[model samples]
Target: MNLNATLFAQLVVFFILAWFTMKFVWPPIMKALDERATKIAEGLAAAERGRQSLDLASKHSAETLREGKEKVAEVIAQAEKRALQIIEDAKLQAKSEADKVVAGAKAEIEQEAARVKESLRERVAELAVAGAEKILRREVDVKAHADMLAAIKQDL
Candidate 1:
C-alpha cells in the first residue's frame, strides 16, 4: 500500500465539515427542542389550572341551588302558618257573632211574650167590667158594685 496525498486531504476536509455542522446546526436544533418542550409544559399547566377552576365553579353552583331551595321551602312554611292563623281568627269571629245574634233573638222573644201577657190581662178586665154592668143594670150602688166586681175578677 502506498501512502497518498489525496487521502490525507480527504481526511482534513471531513474534519472541517464536521466542526462546521456542530457549531452552526447542532446548537440551533437543541435550542428549538428545548423551547418546544417548555411550551408543551406551559400548555399542560394552563390546562390543569382551567380544570380546577371549572370544578370549583360547579361546586359553587350546586351550593347556590341548594340554598335557593331551602329559602323557597321556608317561605312556603311561613305562608302556611299565616293561613292557619287567619282561619282560626275568622272562626273565632264567626262564633262570637253567632252568639250575639242568639242572645239578641232570645231578648226579642221575651219582650214579645211580656207584651202579649199585658194585652191579654187588659182584655179580660174590660170583659169583666162589661158583664157586671149588663147583669146589675142600675140596681146597685155603682162604687160598691165596681169594688165587688173587681174582687170577684181577682178571685177568678
Candidate 2:
C-alpha cells in the first residue's frame, strides 16, 4: 500500500466522524449544559431573594421593637403622672382634715372660756350681796357705806 493513499483515506474517515459527532452528539450536550447553567442562575437568583427577605424581616423586627419601647415609655410616663396626682390628692385631703381638727379645737376653747366667765360673774354677785348686808348691820357712816357699795359694784 502507498503511504500517501493510506493517509488520505484516514483523513476522509476523520472528517466524516467529526461531522457526525458535531451534528448528532454536540447539540444535546450543549443543550444539557445550557439547561444546567440556567438552573444554576435561577438558584442563585432565589438565594439573593431570600437574603433580601431576611434583611427586610430584620429591619421590620427592629422597627417593631422601637415602637414597643416607645409604647412602654408612654405607659411609664402616664403611670408617673397618675402617681403624682394621687399624692397631691392625698396631701390635700390631709390638709383639709387638719383644718377641720383645728376648727373643732378652737370651738371647744371658746366654749370653755365662756363657761369660766359665767362662773366668775356669779361669784362676784354673791360677794356684793354679802358686803351690802354687813354694811347695813354695822350702822357705818352714810358716806363710808356708800363708798363701800360703790367698790362692790365696781367688782361686780
Candidate 3:
C-alpha cells in the first residue's frame, strides 16, 4: 500500500467518526453531564439551606429555654414574696389575738374585785353590830340599829 494514501484514508475515517460522535453520542453524554452538574448544585444549595434552618431552630430553642428560665425565676421570686407577706400577716394576727386575750383577762379580774368589795362591806357592818351588842350586855335590836349599821358600813 502507498503510505500517503493510507494516511489520507485514515484521516477521512477519523473525521467521520468524530462527526458521528459529536452528532449522536457526545450530545447525550454532555446533556447527562450538565444535568448531573445542575443536580449537584441543587443538592449543595439544599444542604446549605438545611444547615441555616438548623441554626435558626437551635437559636430559637435556646431563646425559648432562656425565657422559660427567666419566667421560672420570676415565679419563684413572687412565691417568696407572697410567702413573706403571709408570714407577716400571721404575726400581726397573732399579736392582735394576744392583745384581745389580755384585755379580756383584765376585765374579768376587775369584775371579780368589785364583787369581793361589796361582800366585805356587808361582813364588816354585821361584825360592828355584834360587838356593840356584846359591850352593852344585851341583844341589839335589829331594826333599831339599821341606820347606825349603814353609817358604820359607809365609814369602813
lDDT for each residue of candidate 1 in 60-82, tens digit (9 for 90 to 100): 99999999999999999999999
lDDT (Cα, 0-100) at 51 in candidate 1: 99
State residue 3's C-alpha deviation in candidate 3, in Å. Answer: 11
Candidate 3 TM-score, true structure as reference: 0.67
User: Each prediction's TM-score against the native?
Assistant: 0.56, 0.50, 0.67
Give the lowest summed-lDDT range of ten residues in model 1.
147-156
Instruction: Compose the digit string of candidate 2's lDDT tens values, residues 1-156.
Output: 546688888999999999999999999999999999999999999999999999999999999999999999999999999999999999999999999999999999999988887777767755665666676767666466677666665676
**Tens-place lDDT digits, model 3, residues 14-102:** 99999999999999999999999999999999999999999999999999999999999999999999999999999999999999999
The candidate with the higher TM-score, 2 or 3, is 3
The whole-model lDDT of each prediction reads 0.88, 0.86, 0.89
List RMSD in Å for every model shown: 5.4, 7.6, 4.1
Ranking by lDDT: 3, 1, 2
**Which clashing pairs does model 1 show?**
none
Residue 63 displacement (Å), model 2:
1.0
Worst 10 residues of 2 by lDDT: 124-133
Candidate closer to the true structure by TM-score (higher is better), 1 or 3: 3
